[model samples]
Target: MTTSTQPQAQAKRDEHTQPQAQLAVFDMAGTTIDERDEVYRVLRESAEREGARFSDEEFQKWMGTEKHWAIRNLLTIGGVEATDELVDKAFAWFRDELARTYTANPPSPMPRIEESFAALRAAGIRVGLTTGFSRDIADLILESMGWTVGGGEECTIDVSVCGDEIPSGRPAPDMINKVMEITGVDDPAAVISVGDTEVDVESAQAAGAFSVGVLTGHLTKEAFAAKNADAVLELAADVVNLPQVAAQ
Candidate 1:
């Protein structure tokens, strides 16, 4: 009788020791893929082409946000009317330029990113990608990287949620929540969100999930610290080594 009770108690202890995070949602572009900042460059070029002029400092604030919103805000900041028609034109130009740029030189995964995904999945944590890119652009990038989204064994990511699919993008937690819903993760605390911008941290925090900021993108460690990120990693690939992940 004591042996039976001891086994059951040990099982309970093991359950308690397991990681609470069931899913890890990574940001695209600067977070998981090294896109060489072409997105922002094209955005600036498009806005300028549309007769909107803004300084780099002014443009920097819009990074890591939905492209359409960024274009609208940049146009407004540059004293343009930012009418829907104007914004649409600028967004179209930006998208075309980005697609051409990517086609010319496709983006690649950040260092050890694939290995990190495998490690996280092996630990029984589902891996997902949530991005501010529109669904078509995100699909283009993923196709270029030979990544497929699904739960199949060969699928590179367990799920993916794009900006266009959500009502709002980062800093709003819509993308993160979409990923959680897709992955069937009901508890926000059982998720981990990682990205390279302030909005990423803000979104995760808003969703009540663990947020990790990576330095591979636009933000510095200090910037992430100011945002109160749960952890700051030099690279997205280093996520597998976080205590919360490694212990799993």
Candidate 2:
């Protein structure tokens, strides 16, 4: 069965009390990379191969979550018996397909996202990438994009946190917490988390960081507004224009 949307108290997005972010964390697919439908394409093919079905809404419910978690949800929604072995096998299949497709036609970063990265670095703010993809796939995308990771102080991304690295994914605050720990950012309020899904906003809010919803990703303008992101931007480039970001 699909998971219920359990309500939780969301941390307030108080502008006056919010501190400028020292580090900015961005999601990979949709938010940073233009692999919007490509991800779902692989997902659909893999699910069909495994006899699972997914409508748009069904697929959307797993947005911003780990690939394995999404696979399990898809299996449950498709009425396929979700066995541990089946889930594992299905996840492996999905990963293989995704890696093959990504290898053939690697996605490019979204428009002005690179600009935002450069601008953030120029202003002495660190940048990190968080993704629902596991380390291997995340690394594959980074390598394909020619982006560097890992360094004492200077690297293209400074650091990256993958979904598999944490116990849980978006809406749990784990991935953001991992990023904060890796980057040594003490105050969660001094961080900005950007993603393209409702869970992304929730994750940021739960982590006590500035939440930014970009329009280029999984969420539409109206959907983003409904999620109550601290700020909504037409694209990633517009993030630099936010007061919280600008003051950084």
Question: Top model by lDDT, which number?
Answer: 1
Superposition error at 215 for model 1 (Å) = 0.6
lDDT digits (tens) for residues 26-113 of candidate 1: 9998999999999878989888887888887789878888899989999999989999999999999888889989989999999999
Cα RMSD, model 2: 3.6
> Residue 152 lDDT in model 1?
79
Where is model 1 poorest over a 10-residue stretch in terms of lDDT? 1-10
TM-score of every candidate: 0.91, 0.91
* TM-score for candidate 1, residues paired by index: 0.91
lDDT of 2 by residue, 1-248 (tens): 01123324464476556777688899888888897568877776666678887788878878878888888888888879889899899889889989999998999988878778878877877888998899999999999988887643445777899989877787778888888888788887788888888888888877777888988866887787777777777776677776766876
Looking at model 2, report the run of 10 residues with the lowest lDDT sum: 1-10
Error of 2 at 236 (Å): 1.8
Once fitted onto the true fold, the runs of candidate 1 whose alpha carbons sit more than 4 angstroms away are 1-19
